[model samples]
Structure formats: structure tokens, C-alpha cells
Target: MAAERPVPTHEVTNQVPPVVGRDISTSPALLEGLRREGGGWAEDEVRALALLGNSETWQQAGRLANDHPPVLHTHDRYGNRVDEVEYLPQYHDLMRKAVAHGLHGAPWVDPRPGAHVARAAKVVAWGVADAGHLCPISMTYAVVPALRATPELALQYEPLLTNGVYEPALRAPQDKGGLIAGMSMTEKQGGSDVRANTTVAVPAGDGSHRLTGHKWFTSAPMSDLFLTLAQTDAGLSCFLVPRVLPDGTRNAFFLQRLKDKLGNKSNASGEVEYDGATGWLVGEQGRGVATIIEMVNMTRLDCSLMAAGGMRLNVAHALHHATHRSAFGRRLVDQPAMTNVLADLAVDSEAASAVVMRLAGAVDRAMRGDEAERAFRRVALSVTKYQLCKRLAPHTVEALECLGGNGYVEDSGMPRLYREAPLISIWEGSGNVAALDTLRALGREPAAVEAFLAELELAGGADGRYDDALAVLHKELVDLGDPEDLQFRARRVVERMALLLQGSLLIRHGDHAVADAFVASRLAGDRGRDYGTLPSGIDTRAVLARAAVPE
Candidate 1:
């Protein structure tokens, strides 16, 4: 080292600076969407969250939490079973921030015009901090609607789930300052088909039921309560299972083992055994799917929001790298090919941001008794969940490639983001499951299809390419007569529907550059399959300007 230092050959150069300090909430696409979707009142609150969410300290917390995954302690030294999950303090910090910002169920409590919209913006804003801890946060937000099926249970636990205080202990629900919730439904035997679940719940003389079954996949195993499913005398039913009973004794919920997963390492998903665990019924005894569908829909919406948010982060990292790093005696951002790729990525990311906030708006209005929005959500959420979640992985891959070898390294942060991108597609439902669900919604409720079409019509006549695409889609729908045929083409139909919806929203609300490029490239088929293939006419500079990294 002394000899090398004597030669004076060491130099550090061309390394891109990490995106830090600046507020990530300043995303033009996300902010425009926040205001457009009825969350304008919470812009200041959203910025306040960004003050910490995007800070250098919290960014380090994200890395540390992921680096040190959660540990499960199945038994104590005294030979007593103590089913507990131990996450790093950094993980809890993220959870605390998320809860304090009303990202969980707090929107349900707030009686404001855009309560859900505000919560959604926080989700997108804070999401850049970390994706793993949000598993429990999302479930906590989702459980409220399903729990409301039983007003007494909702009255008891809703306040705690939405509580801003972050309590990380296992105590009686009433005694805890706040609560997190999870769901246990899928088993090895049945993934999406909860009807095939082998779990059985036997009623005790008391109102609660004793659930005895093995859950193949239980998310956030340490959460205080879970909405699970088991077979009863009547049929499949939903039950609220708590880790600690009302009397303050541990229930029979056991963590068999933590799942060795591909990503979301900071979140503890496990193979849980509900061995005679005490649980209370959630809704009508025989209508388990119907009761839990509300929770499922809420989680579905969060999945899409996370997908959208995740895309924004990937673009941010890639664009930041491009803006700073140099190549072949020039900055990467100035290269025409790199510029095309970055601009294409921004266009797709902006489309996602626009649609997710619109869907969040629909969720807010639907919860507030807007029948039209409810119908639209019944169809739109599923389609969006299918399209956006599926798009994120490939989008992330392209973004990762924009940084070349640097992105491949762990320090670049793109690898973690890339790992997290595919989870949402699998979480609420897999791609096929989501696509089929959209088809089911279209089939069951005529109102759903009508609402979906009415929404697409909002951007009518904005662009000729869009109009032509819409005409082709309409003709295809008219010709789509056979159920078997529709099912066969389900994903394709849904993708087209999603693109058209995105195109329409961009035409009406998104930046002009984004709308024109999206319509031209996506609908008109004037581009290649890979990114950076925009036609010569597209304004790459205008689109990238909206996604530019702040000074």
C-alpha cells in the first residue's frame, strides 16, 4: 500500500452519488396524482412524511433491515413454546413511521373528503423507505372493512388497528397501544382456492371456535390478530384468530418455521400451525369468501399502489444514476439510446402513478357510498392489479439494466428493488388468478363492466391513436362471445383494458408528453418490445424533464 501510494495511482471517479436528503415525494407524477385524486388537502402532510421517509437515516435503516432478516424463536430455554418473531429495530422504526402517518387503518377513522386518498399518497411516499414491513401495514389497513362485518368485533379492534401508536408487544388487544393484523388462508393443498382448505373449526360452548389446521403461508406471523379461514359444519368460514387471547394467555398459534423466501426478507412470513387456536367468526358462518372479499379488495388496491410506487423508485434510481454517471466521455443521460430508455421508463411509471391514484380515489368514493365508483373498483382494481404488478418486474429489470454492472451490485439498491417487484403479483393473487378474477367480476356484475367502460370513455376523442385502439377493443369485446374464448384470452383482454384505461387517464390528466408517447408507443404499436425503442418522433426530453432528479 505504501508503494502504491508512492506511485499516486489511486483515484475515485465516475461513481454515481446516492439519491439522498431530498424529498422523494416531490415526484411530479405522484404529486399531480395526489392532487388529482382528491388528496390535495394532505399534500403538506405527505411532504412531512417525506421529511423522514426519504431521509439518509431512514434509507440506511432500509438497508440494515433487509440485511438482517427477521428471526423466529419457537421455544424458550425453559422448554415452553413461545411463538415470536424478532425483527431488527430498523424494521420496527419503519413500521412505526408507517403507522404514525396513518398509512394503516387510520383513514377509516378520519371523516374527511379524501381520507383514503391521503393514506394512499403516504403509502406511495413512504414506500421508497422499504417494502417488507409494509406487509403487516397493508393487512392492518385491509382488515378493517372485513372486520366491520361483525360490528362488535370492529368496535373492539378497529380503533387499535388504526391507532397511531406503535406497540410491538404481544398483549391483550385492548391493552396494546396499537395493533397489526395478518391473514392465514392459503394452504399447500389449495393456493387460491380457499374452498379446498383442510382447516377445521369446531365451536366450543362459548362463542369462539377452536381452529385446528396448518396454514402453508401465514404473512406477518407475529401480528396480534389474523383473519383466517377454516371449514365448519355449514361451509368454509372466516375467523378472527388472535395470537394472545382476550384473557391474556397465548393462543395455540404456533410458528412452525419462517419461510425462506426470494425477497421481502425483512417481513416474516411463516408456516403457522393453528392447533386448537381460539378464534371468533368474522361474518355469516357459511360465507367466508364473501366476507373476506372486502379485505382482499383492499389489499389488492395496496398491491397496485405498491407496484406503482415501486416503479417510481426504480425509475428514480436509474434516472439518478444516468444523470450523474459518465460513459465514453459523456454523461449517460445525454446518450440518445439511454435517453430513450429512461424516457420510456418514466412514461410507464407515470402511467402507473396516474392510474393507482385514480383507483385510490375510486376506493375513497366507494367507501363513502358512491355506487358508481364501487362498481368501477369491482372491475378496475382487478385489471390494474393484474397489469401493474405484472409490469413492475420487467420494468425493474430494464431500469436495472440502465445502470449496467453498477446496478447488479447490492450497494446500488436496484437489486433489492428488483427482488421486491415480483412479490405484489403473487401476494394478493397470481397473474392468472387476478386475470380470472377480472373476468369473474365482468361476468357476475353487469354494473362492473358498465362502470369500467364508462371510465374508459372519459378520455374519448383525446387522441386518434387512442380512439382507434378503443374501437378495436370494442370490436373485440363484441366478437368475444364464448365464455371459453374469453377465458382463453383473458390476460390479453385485461392488458388491453388496462392500457386503454391508462391511456385515457394520461390523455385527460397526465403530462402531454407522457400521454402522446404512451398512446403512440403502447396503443399504436410503434415501438419495440424492449425499452429505449421509442419512435423518432417521441419527445424523450419532455418526458424525462418531469422525472428529473432534483438539484
Candidate 2:
């Protein structure tokens, strides 16, 4: 008998290659978006982003997010209440790198044209690596404007806030070289309704107060200080709560428990009880919502920008895997069906990046005292936040599917990206809340709506599909009917508005192939319900090449 051939058991076939160690900042879509929005970044800022992209440390941060989620320590060995949250060494390493790069407070420290845009781009890049640590970073960035309401407080804290150092010690703000801030605005009863908050703050005779309440969601609870909301004699008010008093003693902040969240696991979010926690009122007593709104608006913009960054990374991973993996004797990316899907994803990512960069530019100009830019920002922020954040999950799911079973495994890193995708939409504000905010913007600031529409009109004649979409949006705005009717259609209006804006941005700034594919598929209804359904005529290969990560 012929000798039976020994079966080879070590063969690994059709395995998708790993996607890492590439410069994320040099992504073609990101570079193009930066250039089109405004090429105002200084050489150092650009170099910083490049370094972040190439750093193995930053890459490790991404791994650490899944491998080492934060843990809460509620008590000491002797049964003393500690209320501490412990993170892995990698988390602190990531935080130190982010702080050293000035991702937290550079824009405010060095005020200049396009400063917010520069800072926002850095946040986007950092978010691609690990988003959880950005909670404190973003709060620190947002708190500056709200702190300005009280000059004394601003003077005492602004330097610490912008010091470009990561001091995680629980001590007095004055003693620390740098500080990170968190926020606790929502309780169990009130999620987005700040007025529904019932936390109480009693006067302490001095310029301070003692807070006694339970915050259902205190994000980054270990921060040096927190900006929280509480009811006072006047009304609901914003207060700056310190973890430690000036005497270097811990405040009466008690951690009840930490939330078991779906994603963003690297950060700690806790249910905290303030048993006479010392706090100082910020702004006026009755205007808590108004004061804290400054912080909320900035965070909302970041929600959109970070979502865009996440989407870009998702597409990059999908394309990289597709190009390297093979089936039926051909690379997956070269296959026509896979090519269409990747091209559609690439278009979505590029358009997202473009719109967010434009929004960041608006924020920059608004900060520079441009009233027109401010007006544009008022409406654009909500619209972009609603649109981009909502797009993240669906786009990420589709991208993951491109990798088949490999993407489903934890080792592939696609599962983590998929898990984190929906968080942006829920955070800052959910979809319905954002939609209503857009409606409120239209009603309160007519010029903001006009500014939004005017920007969309800039690219009207460039594409017939975009022009058609714009016309429909205009008609809906004019014929919005009664308040109830408008409320019922708020999401529809916001979705159309976002698509129109993205279409305009692509037409004006993107390459012809990408712009045409976006308009044809999204605005012209030449696509299906799922991704990778773009029409045959679109330049799928060109779009894929433009968004693919470099070797």
C-alpha cells in the first residue's frame, strides 16, 4: 500500500494580519481633513501628533484599555473607608504621556488662532488609542471657561489646570503642580435634566459651602476636584468640589460603588456620596445650568470629534485587514464586493473627519471673538454631535464584519472598538437630547440656523444631489409646522441637516472620487440599508486607497 501522506496540522490559512505600529496622524484622510479645514497648526503641534501616532507607548495604551480595566477599592485592610479607584500602571503611563503632550489644556494656556482646532486634533488622535483617560482631560479643558466666571477661582486654579503635568495625588489643588477635574451633574432621577437634581448645598459662612448629596454618576472620581451641581437657597447651582481641603485632609467624599459599564472600562465612574463635602460656588447661585453649559458645549464638540477619529481608525483596521487577508486565491480588498464595502466606509470616515474639523475650526474662530463663527458653532455642534456619534456604532459593526470571525475575537481589537462605539452617542447627551438641542438652537438663534444653512449653500452648485438634499432641508425648515409637529420630526430634521452639511464639506474639500461617491450613495439614495452597497459606478478602489493606513 502507498504510504499515507501525513496530515499537516500546523497550517494556518486565510488568517488576517495584525494592524498596528503605523503612524495614525499621517492617515491620508486625517491629513486631508486637517488641510481642508485649516492648515493653521504650528510645526510643533504637527510634530506632536506625528510622535503620538508612532509611539509604542500610545499603542500600548490601546491594549491596556481592554486588558486592565479600572478597579475601585472601597475600604482599607483595617476596614477604613478609602473610596479609592486603582488603575494599572499602563493607565497612568498613558495619562502621563497625554498630559505631557498638553492634550488637556494647551489651547487655553497658549491662546492663538486655531488653538481649539489644534487641541481637538490631538484629542482625536489620543482617542484612537484610548478614550477613557480623556474624561479627566476633557473636563480639565472644559472647566477653564466655566471657572472664568469667578475670577478668584480662575486665578487660583487655571495655572494648575494648564500646567502640562499629571499629578494624580489626592491633595489640595494649591499643593499640586497640575490638576485634573471631573464632573457630577446627573443623579438617578435626572439624567439630562439638571433642574431635576436634588442634591443640597448648605452655606458655610465663608465663600465656600458644604455639599450633602449623592451623585449617581461621578466620572473620574479620583480627580483632584469635581464640578458638580447641587440645589442651594437660590436654586440649582454649579460648585467646585475638592477631594482634599487646604489642610491636606481628605474631604467627606464616600464612594458607594463604581458602575459596571459596557465599555470605556479603563476609566472609573462611581456613585459617590458627599457627606459634608466642601465646595465653592461657581458663578451665581441661580445660574448653575448656564455656568456649567460652557463645559457641556465643549465636551459635546469633543464627542463629535472623537467619534470621527474612532470611525477613521475602524476603517483603517478594516482596510488593512482586507488588503492582507486572502480567500479564493485573491486578496479580500481586491474582491469587488469587499472593495465596495471598504470604499463606503472610507467615504463615511472621510466625511466625518471633514465635518468635525470644520466644527473645530468654528470653535476656534468663535473663541477668537468672531460672532459669525460663534453663531455657526451654536447649531453645528449639536448637529454634528448627533450625526457623527450616532454613526459610530453602525459603521464600526460593518467594519468588523469585513474581518469575519477574526474580528469577533478579542485579540483582533475590533471587538473593543465595537464596544466603545456606542459610548460617544450616550455620553455628553443621547441622540434624542441632541436632536432637541438642535431644535432649540433653531428656535432661539435664527442666525445659527441661517449660518448652518449658509455654509451648506457654499457647495450647492457643485453636486446636483447635494443641491437636492439642501433644497429638501430648506423646505423642511420653512415648513416645520407647529411646535408638536417639529418635536415629532426633530430627529428627521437633524439627520437631514447633518447629511447636507457633510455633503457640502465633502464637495468643497474632498477629492472628486470620494465626494462623488458620498453624494451618490448618501445624498442621492444610491445605496442600501447596510454599508458596502454603493453603486457600481463609484471609484471604490480610489476611496479605499485614500483611507488605508500606510505600511
Candidate 3:
């Protein structure tokens, strides 16, 4: 007999709820798969891999996107807003479909059967990419489903969180969603540099503020709700400016014009001119950057996975074409050269998929209230997003070429995938920022780094693959600051530490297809020589091997 499902309390207010982060206790069949087909990878690793493959959370997202058609908000060709009246019904249907799809899937309903929650998240990522809607609706929609560790400051966002913000905005003929949405925040003078943003947010009477600024690349031009980045007395902060007022009214959030883009034709990317528009603050004064980062961090992984899905789809199409389309008598799949290309494509896609799933598992674990797990998961997520998104465009290009002349044609569907792939890397802080984030994480958790190394040592068992890699990485880190060149030493230490932690996990895990994974991180010991850039620090190697368990 099947196990009974757990009852969950539905809270649709300021506090964003997290996806169920329960422990896995079922699925003997899947557990058997891990033991058999996982190719020597650890049990944790196997479980993590399965999370994205069969999660309920992602299934919901996919159903919603597939069900909803694109809704145009701004009538102007260049604007990027969704018409509130026309879009709400579709949005409601989409959210309901997502929720239903999720509930229907297992593991999400019962973690023991498999990693259904993780799989569902992946499905959602893919669906979002396929939908190609420029509306920031997803941005709002995503937060409420599973609030997790986010702050409860935005109680006003409760009504909006229900996927019902469009209702009142659609009540009237000229009603826009909120106030300022789909406005491009980037400028020609400063780019995405928030510190240099010239948008001025001056206080106005009636507890509102006027936003006067010029922004480029307004996505979803018809959005009445504009969330813009501006300079405040404290520094850079985001303001919630509406084209309409709080009492179901319209305000002065104006549009300058829209810009033509290479792709996303169904959507408009425009330059926006806000002529002293009324606005409300999002967080603390001058802390917009931090608030924005919170949103960006959550979504960056989504973007990366989206790009991965597009690449996967593109490659799948090409592989199918090669099998069916004939060039010289036999099919292209029959050609050894074409087959080799497909093999390489498959390998890349599978590897990318594995890493993305693992990262998602980490996020899932973190959301379930594990602090140590959360820190590493966040770091790993950022790195995976950076690496995967960067690889996506190249992978798609290769797949398109494999499809030959047909790939170049618009009707082939390869062009759309190719067009959307690059944005993953460009948006969400780019490659450099991502790399730096990885490096920064190492700086924060030196002990976690040590603990990870110790786990590798245990998994390695003396002179195994894990042992050899761990030793080399450890040696490099130990001797990194000997020359004492400050900046150079700091960089080397970070690089070595990152390599050490990453190599350790890979070695210990060995790419297992999983259901629930926890990378073992033993705390560092109190003894041993200090090896970081800072001299005279406590040595962490011993701590890692004999670190005490937390109470």
C-alpha cells in the first residue's frame, strides 16, 4: 500500500514558505537503483542526482508555462508589459496548473519515494524558458510558493503574492498592473552599475516618492508595476513605483521608447523615461543592491537551468533529425562523424544536467533549515549556474551546426534556442561576478573547506583517486603563502581552496545518480600549521580530521 500524504498549512502572506524539505524515507526501488547503477558514486550523490530528474516542484512549473500563452500588455510594439485584463486569467490558470502538477508528482508529496521536489524545480526552469514571457510575473509568482529563508518585510506583497495582483489592475480599461514594470534599469552611460545609477527618488507628499530617471532595456513595457534601482541617502536601493496608486489608481510612470533586440521578438526590450514617478521603498534606505542580490541569486540558477533545457532541447531535435533525415542514401545518424558529434553533445548535456541537479539538491537541503548545508549549497549553486550557463551557448551552437542548413532556418526551432542561450551568462552578474562569488565563499568557510577535504580523505581510503587529488590540492594550499606576496598569495590560496573543496566532493561522490545527498563536511581540527594567506592562524587540517559534532 502507498504511504499517506502529509497535510501542509497554506500561508499566503508576507512570509514566503519553502518547498517541503522533509527527509527521504521511502522508494526502495530508487534506493536499489542508487546501489546498482550509480557507478561507485556515494548514496548521497545518487539521491541528489535524482532530485531534478523526478521532482514534483518542477512538474508544476512546466504545466503552468505550457498551459499559458504569451499575453501582450503594452499595445506599442516596443513596450514589454502584459495587459492586466487579458493576462490575469492565463496567469491564474498557469499557477494552478503548476500547483496541481506538483501535488500529483511523488517524492514532493513523499520524499522517501524519490527526489520529486528537485525534479519539479527543473521542470519549471525548462517551462519558463519555453514560455518566453517577458512579464516579471514569474518573479513574483516564484517567491510565494516557498518562502524559505527570505525576510518577511514585504507584507504588502501578500495580495500580490497570490497571483492576484493583476485583478484590480485589470478592473479598468486603462489600468496597468501596478506602476512601474518592464522598465529597463540599465543605462548607456553606466550599464548595470547600480552605484552609478542617476535615477533620483525624491520624496513626495501622501507617503509616496517621485522617481525621475532614464533607463534602457525595459522588459515587459506594459507592466504598470515598475521595480527600479535608484540612489538613496544610504546608497543604492530599489523602489516599488507603480504606474497606479495603492488604492487601485494610475500614476505617472511613463515610458520613453523601446529598443529592438536580436531575439525575444515576442517581447519588447525598451528604454524607459520616468518623469518624477511616485514610488515606495522596497527595503532599508540604500540597501537596494542587497535586496536585488537576493532576487538575483535565487533566479540566476533558474536562468542557468533554463539555458541548459534549451540546449538539451536543441540537441535532442538535432539528434532526431540526424536519425530521420537522409543525406546520402542512409540517415545522418548512420554517419560515424555525425554520431560522434551527437555523442559529445549527449555527454556535455548529461554532465551539465548532473551538476545543475546536484546544486538544486543543495538548495533544497538548505531551504529545509540546515544552516551548514545552506551555505555550501548557495556557493555550489552560484558556481554551477556560472559554469552551466557559460557552456550552454557553445553547446547549442554545436548542436545547430550538427543539424546543418536546417538549423539556420527559422522554422527549424534551433534559432530560438540559440537566441535565448546567451542571456543566461549576460544577466545575473556575468561570469566574472560568479567566479568571484565562488572565491568569496571559500574565504567565509575555511573550516567547511577543511571538513570537505577530510571527508574526501575518508572516502579516498589512503591512496585512492580521492586521496591523490586531495593530497595534491592540500599541498598547494599549504605552501601557497610561503612566498608572501599578499595579493598573489590571497588569490592562490582561494584558488587552491576552491579546487580542494570541489575536487574532494567529486572524488568522494564520483557522479552518482541520487535521491537525497549530503556532502560530508567534517569540522577542521585545532592543531596543524596555519596554511592560509594570513600567517599565524590556527591550522585547519587537523580540525577537519577530528572536528567535533555540533550539538
Instruction: Find the candidate with the highest TM-score and give its number.
Output: 1
- Count of backbone clashes for each model? 0, 1, 48
Which run of 10 residues does model 3 get worst, by summed lDDT? 514-523
For all predictions, the C-alpha RMSD in Å is 1.5, 2.6, 15.6
For 17-108, candidate 1 gives per-residue lDDT tens digits of 76887665457877888898788999998877765777888989989999999999999999899989999999999999889888988889
Report the error of model 3 at residue 546, Å: 41
Question: What does candidate 2's lDDT look like per residue over 1-551, in tens digits?
Answer: 99999999898867754565665544555566565556456445654665575467666776876577778888999999888888888788778878887878877877667677777777777666687888888888888889888899999998989888997868778998999988889999988987999899999998789999889988899998888999998999999998888999889999998899888888888999999999999999989999999999988988887788888888888888988898988999999999988999889898888888898888877877889999999999999999999999999999999989989998777888898899889988899999999999888889999999899989978778888888888888887789998999999999989988888887888878999999998888999999989998898877877887767
lDDT values of the candidates?
0.91, 0.85, 0.48
Clashing pairs in 2: 341-532
Best of the candidates, lDDT: 1
Error of 3 at 496 (Å): 10
The alpha-carbon lDDT assigned to residue 365 of candidate 1 equals 94
User: Looking at model 1, which ten-residue stretch has the lowest summed lDDT?
Assistant: 1-10
